[model samples]
Target: MEKYGVEVQEKKQVKEEGLQELPGTHENIVLRFAPNPSGPLHIGHSRAAVPNAEYVKRHNGKLILRIEDTDPKRVYEDAYEMIPEDLKWLGINPDEIVYQSDRFDIYYDHARQLIEKGAAYMCTCDGAAFKELKDNCKACPCRDNSVEKNLELWDKFDTMDAGEAVLRVKTDINHKNPAIRDWVAMRLVDETHPRLGNKYRIYPMMNFSVSVDDHLMGMTHVLRGKDHLANSEKQKYLYDHMGWDLPEFIHYGRLKMEDIALSTSKALEGIENGTYSGWDDPRLGTLRAVARRGIDPRTIYNLITEIGVKMADSAISWKKIYGLNRNLLEPIANRYFFVEDPQLIEVKNYEGGKVIVERPLHADHMDRGNRLLPFDGSAYLAKSDIADGVFRLMDAVNVDIKGDEITYNSTSFEDARDLKARIIQWVPAEDNVNVTIVMDDASLKTGLGEAALSDLNVGDIVQFERVGFARLDEIKDNELVFYYAHK
Candidate 1:
């Protein structure tokens, strides 16, 4: 289950430290996973959610689920609904759901107070104008407007056109980073928000809403992507200016690489352009895709735990993830029979009787017991395994096939002992049982006609006979069912 490169010895030391008792009583600490409702969450988001949830659980604290739906135009209904479900699928439960769109008045009230205190001002410069002006350029004429005039203009949100002007937090333009230099706090948006209809016009940006909410909600510790480390400094500045207490900031590295794009906008573009099937495409590192691929949440959690809280950025290979999943599922999965590309074989010279052969449901585990399989003097086997004009039948006999007829050379069953290549799976071809297996579109190509077993009820995990572990998605009557398997 170890995905990270950390040594087992080191992990034991860390685990021992984590198991030690805390020096003080647990505080009423609150951590948050503030995902923007712009697109489906990818695997990078899972990295954050897993650790934050684990930390909260370890310390007996609260994990708040916050939807940063500040962008009116970009917010999607599906994104908001799927986020909580995805987190729950990963075993991370939140104590409360908070939407930034619901607190526009609070953001505005604080924005206005900053204006009254001469800490913020309205800027009429558009994007092009600001880009041309740059840092050395003169401040817009509206920057010097009286706070009373700004308040009067702010109240006219109902009449203002979108992007006509914006409220900017007052910061030194000469600051090292341009983001700290009078960043926009709020702007008018004419589009309707999915959650909050058209009740308001102006919306707060990430810098504004995150700072205000984190302080108000009493978030004692913040764990976020490393890209926000610089933004944290700006937030710290805001807290200092407002005489508010600041929280301990922990910035972890992002999971990214040149080939992989974690951006929601990029993912949407891929979906639209047919570069990917959907957000849950197996090729994409999204939580839904990982879950659908049968990777357990415990494995994902263990990977993050092994990686620990490091500031260095790293990209994980897909093989490593799959390997960990295989390890976690190996001991628990059962064994069964599955014959793909089945070829029928008819017995020619039998002793006028049907012979029943039984094999245990699980190998090396007697508790699983056995199932009766009808067999005659002959049995169908996979055609691909036959080689060089010779066929081995469980090593007990050798057969030659010519013109749909198989000729056996040996008659003793003892000769088949310990024949690894001869071992194969079989199902009753004469049986009337029917099963329909549902798989991701990507896997459908290579997995066709491979004894796909799907006759399972919901919540049932059955061995795919010999293929792998499969869980029943849904079952209709006793004939048809849909199943998903873990590789």
Candidate 2:
């Protein structure tokens, strides 16, 4: 059996299996994947996006891609386009695309409704002062203002500068969670929104905007991080105030990927400081980075689905993703030869002159055709594989190496097997392309790849025989650049 065959089989079984039933009414099931457009969608974002999309597909429901870009400071202008492009690459097609910046009026109207119902109030108190009062289980002085007064105060929001005022939802002041006690619903942001510009001074807070949108947009299930569990309690007040039916809130566990940075702000900082490349830098966990490395979107989908919406936290290593990705790439990615840090070896006592080696692109799938390589008596083998030994030169010849001497032996696999020979890959010294592989650590490995690699276009994933799998990233100036995916 092939490596990861059982794991891949298990994944196939998971694909055939359905997720546990959602708790709410099945009729008109709608889900929304609301990601703040701080940066391109990363693997963390996929954890939320994939499940919603898969559930929608299973139930024949609607999935909304909501760009929660209300925070002018955090919004990345490029993310407005990058987010959708990343999602499209992930095969998650939202039924509707909406931006929170476009729905300020709607959020404002909902705020007005809460104010009219005396369930929300505009607090002109300083942030620190309001926090002091709320911490003591006491309402801020502004909290007691009349509904009419609050409405008048809300009307004066345009006149308010940033940080001067915020609309607070009426929650239990004595609630155990101080963070939830009278949470701010909306605040004044004087900064120009990336999408909206200076059109409005007031902006809805994440919880407020998310709650309002989920309710108004008819979101049937709200898939969110477990960290939002308290926010879930906070949003319930708005639902109660507006007499709106609450969406089924599903709080999934925290998915902390080991060693993979998911911070958009930090990634942007790295890019700006020249500490890293762009969003798709090999080290980044962004979907673009993963895609550039030839990681199939289905790998993410399958992995996330297998994790499902469990509340138990999952801390996964890159190996987990690589294992799953390897399963998906094994049967598809073609094979080639890449000799890293090449050591030249003379094929002495070779009766054959110039030989053309035609190896199958994919051993199991012969229909994929062959990769042809013409070998003379000289070949480039990796320096690490040049130790004294009896070795098989892949589809070429068997060789006996002792010290500086390397002499050709019989080519029969049976003969090589009889001696328990090591198998090593090699590229013909003269008939190879200069290749550079960008490793996962953002390090570069320069080598000589089989001339056949030049035929592969950008974005093609290929296994470098004894080397690992890599995706062709660029072909320029007679050199092939690849991003190493995994072993």
Off by over 4 Å in 1: 1-26, 257-284, 347-353, 389-405, 409-414, 417-421, 432-455, 459-470, 474-487
Per-prediction TM-score to the true structure, in the order listed: 0.83, 0.93
lDDT of 1 by residue, 1-487 (tens): 5655467657665443322322233487788989888877777787678767877888889999989999877897899889998888888889999999888889988888888887788777787777555466446666789998888877785577888888877776667776666778888877888888888878887899999999889888888889998788778767866778888788888776335665778778888899877877655667776676567777777776666567888777656765787787666655555444556665344453465556565576768676555655555555554444444543234555566766654445544443322544545545323444545445431122222334334655556644665544445555444344455
Best by TM-score: 2
Lowest summed lDDT across 10 adjacent residues in model 1 is found at 444-453
- lDDT string, candidate 2, 69-169, tens digits: 88899888999899999999999888999998899999889889899999999998988988898889998888789999999999998797888888999
lDDT for 121 (candidate 2): 95
RMSD of each: 6.0, 6.0
Top lDDT: which candidate number? 2
Report the number of backbone clashes for model 1: 6
**Candidate 2 residue pairs in backbone clash:** none
Give the per-residue Cα lDDT of candidate 2 at 114. Answer: 90
Candidate 1 similarity to native, TM-score: 0.83
**Every candidate's lDDT:** 0.68, 0.89
